[model samples]
Target: MKGRVIVLDHIAGREAAALLVDGKLTDLLVDDDSAPRPGAIFRAVCDRPIKGMGGMMLRLPDGETAFLRQGKGLALGQSMLVQVTGYADDGKAVPVTDRVLFKSRYAIVTPGKPGINISRAIRDDDVRDRLLACAHEAGVAEGFGLIIRSSAAEAADEDIIEDIAAMDALATAIMADADGAPEALTEGDGPHVLAWRDWVEPAKVVTDAGGFEDMDVLGQMVSLGQPRVGLDGPAFMYVEPTRALVAVDVNTGGDTSPASTLKANLAACRALPRALRLRGLGGQVVIDMAPMSKAHRREIEGALRSAFKTDTVDTALVGWTPLGHYELQRKRERLPLPAEVMEALA
Candidate 1:
């Protein structure tokens, strides 16, 4: 409870992983079998261009259509490789990208981008040099780029080199299959794999059966179903999701001091990222912060920025709206918690 713990288990027959820090559920990954997962590579055929949207539709071998924005100059019936970027909304085509990447725990292989780069977080000169050496030793193919992830800083030299080699080989194999008909080249990493890949920090790993129950992960997950998230300063926030956007309402529970509004707003900013992450909520987010003076807007903005800086999801803080609401645009990287998952936990 005082440190980090990773719980790998099955929920409702789906593979799942949960990260707990200081006894609190910090992050979660659950498999969604219904849709093509993000990071899945496919050789798709160009269908038709939607000039009005500045994008094109693609036809996959499974008879599903994907939307690729900024896909210009793709002639009809032409075969090209694409990667699923995120899940689609109801009745919408899955979003795909032309820029496909092969990612692993220690290295990421970029096909078109040719260069060897180190993570900026690894500031030690010796570490950076050693990581660069590892990348060079792995031997990146021509027209491909290698990125040494920050996790490689503490990893063994051989392990880093091996990871790089594996990713490079995978990218080569996938690219070579682009000449064929539209079909899925490779599926994305599942929950357990993603947990190991992304949650690289020091933590106790639990893989035994009933580990979720033993670690109280199921109890914590139950709370995620509710919209209420308690914050510091005795504040609270309701993170409700609707069809259009996620609406967050912050309130100062029992604090009536003159600084209550600002305190509650800042607390909401700090707790928001985790709440959204656990809920698997994304897309448009409108935060109706507790009533505060306009002078404190910059401070709230700074708090929001600091809060989401470490979050893994792609989020854009769009600043305050005219109606005193703060807006955020988040990428739908994770699917919403399905009903079956909650039932299984229960």
Candidate 2:
């Protein structure tokens, strides 16, 4: 649950912002004060004969040039429209495009840049018109253009407005050389908050042992309400895995039973996904789940899905794999849950 923010100038006159809390990228704010983009149609001009390829390197009217693949009969100064597919999510670098030679739309990804060319709305409209139309469709209010982020997919219009303003302000300040302001746009709030806020009512704070000061805020919020208490167990557990066998001893305090074991198992399953997110688990992770019951199994599965819904970054539950347990693979980038979670677990 802990993270930090960094700001830098990216676009010609815009600031690029990245928020990484708990080592995971929570927000990306770009294109706050710069020109919308080179969102226009242009004709490619033969600049110079490309050394190896037959077609010359074509210069675009918008001032970008890329090599047009040889032979398919494109000539010098040909007129056509190019749309942005995907550009750098960071606002500073503009996107690049290629002439639509194929019937299907294609994205022109520039090397060393996050440029993606989206197919234009209409082949006939001017570049600016298509850009504005796309912006309008995405609900960008003014002359400002934006690359709607993944976080905004389900947000209300107001949240989107708030985010866009945060991005705009941050970007403008970056350009004006006045950047040191505390940011209001945090690493994007994932569905976790929404889930934790909406679904899992804080039953109570569970502690691994004596350390609970780190969770002071959460504890305080739920202070008025009663929370479930589990146990203050051993410092850790050692899981032994032979080439094919893994032995896990379900160690609780003095009192351990089938019901308590199931409860602890359910609790961990419910918390594990969110905990995994909080820790920012990366790449292939094999959690040797301790065994549990059939009826309890459904509840654990449901809870796992609910907790993970809030993840802002990409993750997938392939369900339980061929192994004895399920598999959770993080996209490998970004941070996972913080260590404090493991420290705080009861």
Candidate 3:
């Protein structure tokens, strides 16, 4: 409860993984078998282009369609490899990109971009040199780029080289199949595998059966369904998802001090990223912060920036709106909790 804990378990008979930090649920991954998951590579055939949208629709072998935002130079009948970028909305085609990538725990292979790069987080000169040496040792294929992930900083040399080699080989195999018909090249990793890949922090890993119940992960997941998230003393925020956007309402509750509004707003800012991560909420976000002096805007903005700095999701803080509300645009990287899972939990 005092440190990081990774729980590999099942929810509603689906694979699920939860990360708990200091006994609080900080992140979660649940398998959703309803749609093509992000990171899945497919061989697709170009359909018709949407004139005004500057994009084209692709037909997958499984009878599903995907939308590529930049479809220039693609012929109607051309076969190409595409990767699913994110889950689609109710009536929208699945968002995809022609730029496919092969990712693993320690390395990421980029096919078009041919270069050896290291994670910017690894600033130590010796570590960078060592990682570069490992990359060179792996002997990545020509015309393919390799990225040494930050997790490789502490990993053994042999492990890093092996990971790079594995990813490079996988990319080679996948690219070789580009001449074939439209079909799924590879499915994305499930919750357990993703947990091991992305949650690289040193932690206690719990993989036994009934671990979710024993560690209260199910209870925490149930809490994610509610809108209200408690912040500091007598302060809270409600994260409500609507068709258009996710609206966050911060309140000071019963506190009436002069600095109460600013305090509550800051607390809400600190708690917001984790709340959104656990709920798997993304897209447009609008925060209706408690009314405070205009002078405190900079301070609140700084708080928000610091809060999201460590969040893994791609989020852009789009400054204050004309009406004084703050807005954010986040990538739809995770699917929202499904209804059947909630029913099963209930």
Candidate 4:
């Protein structure tokens, strides 16, 4: 599978990153430094306890505050480890936990937690059993837990062991070095890096002059320009994301034939998930698909489900509404992609 093309352009003075698969926009990359994300580990100092809320306020080294449950007997100014569980928007405290986890491409490693767990996504009993046996033979140090990722189902035993061992060492290092005021011991995956890992290896990477060094091509097929990319033929889509929901409209453009329209509609379904990821479109999302018969709607839905499986964030199809509009619910943690991008631009 060919990896999607990543375009870094300056949109309204701020850097804009876009992902394109098969010449169609998949997602828009955005970043926010203020919010703590899942899988990020931090060493924080416990401030005062909130008996009413059953938690304690933690001041991070970076000056951000997070709230942790179970404050009883916890003295003030005590240093602790915390990981972001979820965002508590609406002026509420950010939820955090002491249970820290580290994830690689193939496994999730935990410190002070023993035993091995397998991802439920791996449904093959035989494969799961084999992986379990491999984990056992890994001989990982005590006080650590390893959860095999579904991506490891096709991996060799040695590779799995190596990944686990590396993760174990990383976990140990983090604990040993995590000290002092609240600070991050580890950073979450970058948007582009995570996208590449989950999707395809990039066939070509393009950027403007004096762009990010890491994304420039000397060894890779990198191009320098104004960072503009266009889709071939007549397939196109207009994506508008609101505070509460995202609306995507698919168009076949000049294609008028029945077969061509169906083809365009199917392509749009394939592109919709990618657009969602690129834009980080979470919460309720409605795709206004091209008008088609009921029989074709099933095909479009199936295509959408297949494409959605590749999304890094959790999403579900709520089925078609009475108005014949396809409804979807995606998990909301941080602000949507557009909001973050606009903030940066501002």
Candidate 5:
């Protein structure tokens, strides 16, 4: 399979990155330097307790709030280590976690958590066992756990060990500085880089000459592009995402062939997942596909799952609704792409 190509451009004075999968624009990212990306580690304080939700509101040094599920380890004004797991959307605060996870290209190091866990994407039992043994022999810190990412499926033992050691050292330092004022220890890559890297396999990165060179992109595309994209010839399908859910509607534009209708719908099915990823649409998503037979529906379902499996975020196919709408539930932890775009535009 050809690797996806990322096209970086400038739109409205902000850096925009467009993902091209098979020469098609699959995703778009607007570089908002003001946005706090996922995986940012910070020292935070417990400010308000939500008794009903079983999580407390934490105040980052920047004055942003994130919810912490476990409050027993925290006092009202005490500072502690937390990772920004997700951003706030639709009136919700950012999601913060006490369990700090350090991510590398090959592995994830979870401090204060023991045992080795492998990625579910790696299905081979023997490979799992081999990675398990590697983790065991890698000299893990006493309480830290190492998760073998799908990217690590072909990694050398030395690479895994080195990744663990580096992340563990960083974790140790963060823990040691827990008593300090609320502050950020490390910041993750921008939204485009973060999303691209999270894919199960690495993709080719590119940018335009006037794009974000400081971001260390691999290559450059011709120019900056628009966020909204229309595909499938004269017939256009409109895709828009909101904080609550993403809605995709298919427009045949007067095409009458049964084969043409099916072809367009199936193509839409293939395009929607990548588009959602590009837009950073998460949580509940629905696709309003052109009506088809049960067999074709099954085909679309399989295609949808296969396409979504490539996504780094955890996505659950909820089947179709009674009204023939397809449903998907994606885990929401960070700010949705539209939210960031709106923020940047504002």
Candidate 6:
């Protein structure tokens, strides 16, 4: 399946969610609670770039070392555990990465993502409630928030109940099993992945066309109402990340517009910023707009800027050198999406 990647951040506590599909990353949704909390570890008011003081480690509310460095980006009303992705020659904060050690401080919850975070300060009632908590979407009751994942959307309450039961038992059984492991817990596809897959896949794969059908047989489309669907295809892929480097190669193909190579190529140019956004490509992005005309150059430049509006992270076209290449500087956030996202339309 051409799976997408999403990193769920700041849920319940300073925790990050690893949303991977078939392994390629398609999205990164960092969960930051939009609510106000008392004595929150990372207060939202500290809206400044990390000072990267000798790559200091932050002590989390749960007492984990949230790492941080100098020059990390900070959002308004957001908190984080950070460490410098870069360090000075003397081992101080480097203006570079500003890597965050911990996850987002915004441990807020909502619908659309299914999850259950048992507090470290587990209460007997909380444990019992988790143990006896009806996974049934309809009957779920407790002080703790219950995320009903997308996979469970059409699932019978009984099935979810059993899932909850199994999950609780597994958590219970694993406590003894986690004898020496420092990193707490184990996992499977949490509800967020299931919901997202359910939501985005169908609309992307509406193939009523010939034999290349989306035949899960059970591969049914949402007949009534709900969210969208995502397709499971080979076009998607995930790649190992390395220090800031990116290359985009436009392969002439079915959509390459033979009518006018310039226009087709222009589409590709217009696509750079978006392609970058969807895939979260960072570090210097070197773009080759497939060699075109002088006037075409101006048009391509304009298109590149227009597409850049979609970027959540800051970026700039540092102008092309005499080599006819453009430069794009992207932020280094969590795991980036794979470069393969553009090939899906292929």
TM-score of each: 0.98, 0.34, 0.98, 0.62, 0.76, 0.36
Candidate 2, 298: how far from true, in Å? 2.6
The CA lDDT of each predicted structure is 0.93, 0.37, 0.92, 0.68, 0.69, 0.38
TM-score of model 2 (CA atoms): 0.34
RMSD of 4: 6.8
> What tens digits encode model 2's per-residue C-alpha lDDT throughout 192-233?
222222222223322233222343322321211212222234
TM-score of 1: 0.98
Q: Which has the greatest lDDT?
A: 1
lDDT of 3 by residue, 88-116 (tens): 87788989998899999999999999999
Give the range where candidate 6 is weakest over 10 consecutive residues by summed lDDT. Answer: 217-226
Give stretches of model 3 more than 4 Å off. Answer: none
Candidate 4: residue 300 Cα off by (Å): 3.3
Question: How much is 283 displaced in model 1, in angstroms?
Answer: 0.3
lDDT of 6 by residue, 231-308 (tens): 122111121223546665443343334434465555666545434543434667776555556566777778778877
**Candidate 5 C-alpha lDDT tens digits along 1-346:** 2557665666556556765666555556655455566778888877878888777888876777778987765568888888876655656677778888888777788888887899998999988888887777775677888888887788788877777777778777777788767787888666455554554345676554643343322122211113344557645577776656778787666777777667777777767766666556678888888767767888888888788776667789999889988888877643443443444444
lDDT of 3 at 212: 93
- What ranking emerges by lDDT with the best candidate at the front? 1, 3, 5, 4, 6, 2
Show the colliding residue pairs in model 3. none
What range of 10 consecutive residues in model 4 has the weakest lDDT sum? 219-228
**Candidate 1 regions off by >4 Å?**
none
Candidate 5 regions with alpha-carbon error over 4 angstroms:
1-30, 70-75, 120-137, 191-234, 259-261, 292-297, 332-346
